[model samples]
Target: MKNYLFPHIFQPIGWIMFVLSLITGIAIYSSIPVFGAGIAETLAIDSAIIGIALGALFIVCSKERVEDEMTKSIRLASLLNSIYAYVALLVGCTILINGVKFLVFAVFNLVLFPIIFVCNFRLEMHRYNKMCEDEEQD
Candidate 1:
């Protein structure tokens, strides 16, 4: 089955937003000492979170140039692999950081799942493309 994706333009926009969000998030974290627990700091953090979430969603949902069954299968495999890896990491980290540190780690860990999936998907796609090229050359 074919999968529908966002317009080609969204991919680059998503990447830009993702980077900007990361920067904004870092800046907010850095400013926490100065701002304390005020509404401004809360708003900044919330905005950064929203931006990052939306950016990741756009990137993940964007269609590939060639959205074939093989590509879809690769995507599914990558997602499953990412989930498995994330769960393993979560379990291990829970054991290692069984305190206030775990709470902090968990917040960051939530974002890692999508990042890991995207990375794995890209790697798989690259490998598939290379294999296809090699086959064609043979």
Candidate 2:
């Protein structure tokens, strides 16, 4: 199979879904506006749009690899991290909450969670590969 970042169910269908989702996300978000107003706002981007884009890209790029032990571990780790991060935010809520600061953290988490998961996946992959290499050498 051609290597892609996500697993596309059907190429044409996937493309259609991707386009539709992206447009919908952008449309809803742009209602509030992204950057500015009228002609001044060159790019009116939103986190929702980014999320949609990421989902589409993920589907396009997903590999067919089965979940191995290490893969499972990585997923568990990422999930734990995400949960902890969310809990931390919840705990932080008790401290003090400036709306803007909270919004920033929310956005940051939105952008960050996937990145953290991807990194964790890579870390597990590396360990798995290294172990395999050692076994081969032995």
Top candidate on lDDT is 1
**Superposed Cα RMSD, model 2:** 8.0
What's the lDDT of the predicted structure labeled candidate 1?
0.79
lDDT of 1 by residue, 30-138 (tens): 6646445779778767777777877877777787777778987897899899899999998888888978888878767757777787678879999999999999999
Q: In candidate 2, what are the lDDT values of residues 1-138, reduced to their tens digit?
A: 333344435434544555555565546444655345654443334544464456544633454256445555565676677567666765676367766777755644554554454455556667877898999999
lDDT of each: 0.79, 0.54
Candidate 1 TM-score, C-alpha based: 0.82
Q: Which ten residues in a row have the lowest lDDT in candidate 1?
A: 28-37
Among all candidates shown, the one with the greatest TM-score: 1
What's the TM-score of each model vs. the native? 0.82, 0.48
- Which residue runs of candidate 2 sit more than 4 Å off their true CA positions? 1-44, 47-61, 64-73, 89-99
In Å, residue 71's CA in model 1 sits off its true spot by 1.2
